[model samples]
Target: MKRTLVIGDIHGGLKALIQVLERAKVTTDDTLIFLGDYIDGWSESAQTIQYLIELSEKQECIFIKGNHDVWCEDYLRIGKANRTWLFHGGALTFEGYQQLSDEEKKKHLNFFERMKLYYVDDNNNLFIHAGYTSMKGPEQEFYKSNYNWDRTLWEMVLTMDKRVKKHSVLYPKRLKIYNEIYIGHTPTLYYNIETPMNAINVWNIDTGAAFTGKLTVLDVNTKQYWQSDNVNELYPNEKGRN
Candidate 1:
């Protein structure tokens, strides 16, 4: 069986991310999947994008668009939008951008636009930035428009009757898209949590690394999780940054 490493939200902690990857000992043959939130929160947003772009070029790395990344793209396109961008850990992303040269800023913005909303491998493992949508029927039909910046769909998935939420109600008939689905966005107390219904099937890898929690990575096949010990201590005063 091929080994797949699914990573949770990096939140611009490049130091912690590099350490996690090094610890995982990722190689060219292994598939490394990132469940978005690549930028925003700590610092080094631009550098994080550059590093992911470089890694994508060299190895089998798949990226999904996280909500924060959507905010970054919007800020780059229109300079501003909702206050959620500033409130939900976007100020650090702005700080990272300010540290970059004009050319680098342009490069990272372009890269962000090209990120995929979801990645589904041949093995059936689904990787999404946030939670999966609650829309049903055909996969392509739902993913085409619903996957991009659809907060309503994400909310439904997160709060839907906890019992059915584990399995993709968005497309009930086709729930077996993969052996399991890996996601971020919702931080869990544990580095990884298996759905009560599915045992070790559905995995939530976000351990609130940007807040008072740890960053997480999981080996899907083995169900082994790796986590950072500390949060970004220098995240800056949230109120002041906003």
Candidate 2:
């Protein structure tokens, strides 16, 4: 049977990304769903995007946009760097793009332009970069920023998982909408977790490749996961989004 692999935040660690794919034994038959933040942090952000563009040509892939991705896209389109972005790993991404030609930049920009904020599969599994506020669904969400920035969804699940029964009237209706929901903006590392973390049906796959943790790939159906060596270990000389 084919696997539907859900990938976590990359944060420009192309080596870690490649390692996880190899460790997972990914093939064209597998469907890859990336939770975004493809760039920023490490020194290889531009090269990472190039690899993904090539990877998608033959493999089945779905890309969701994250907050860091938005910053990269903005810089590529407007040619002005955000000071806030620079503080949070954008400087590395800016430097990575410096060597690329204008045509290549446009192609990369187009790739970012095509990213989706959220996607719901036939099985009602939600793949979003971050949490949403809408009780109905992400489509019902008014502020699109929540799709890239909110942490309340995960926070709620963590707080309520043991307190409320899923069938209880007090259980979160938002969690009831999907069979499973996968997200990446908030790192599992923040919770001192080195692997994917789960509360109820929400899976937090961001193992913090942007910082000191590893990159992870999850088989959405089997819940079997593979991880790369710590990104900090991969680039000892570079401080990755520290």
Against the true structure, whose lDDT is highest? 2
**Which regions of candidate 2 fall more than 4 Å away from where they truly are?**
161-163
Candidate 2 C-alpha lDDT tens digits along 1-242:
78899999999999999999999999999999999999999999999999999999989999999999999999999999999999999998998899999999999999999999999988999999999998898999999999999999999888774767778988888988999999999998888999999998899999999999999999999999999999999999999999
Per-residue CA lDDT of model 1 for 148-179, tens digit only, reads 34434334334545465435544343344456
State every prediction's TM-score relative to the real structure.
0.77, 0.98
Instruction: In angstroms, give how far residue 160 of model 2 lies from its true place.
Output: 0.6
- Could you say which candidate leads in TM-score? 2
Give the distance in Å from residue 185's predicted Cα in candidate 1 to where it truly belongs.
Answer: 0.6
CA error at residue 223 for candidate 2, angstroms? 0.5
RMSD to true structure for each model, in Å: 4.7, 0.8
lDDT of each: 0.67, 0.95
Number of backbone collisions per candidate: 2, 0
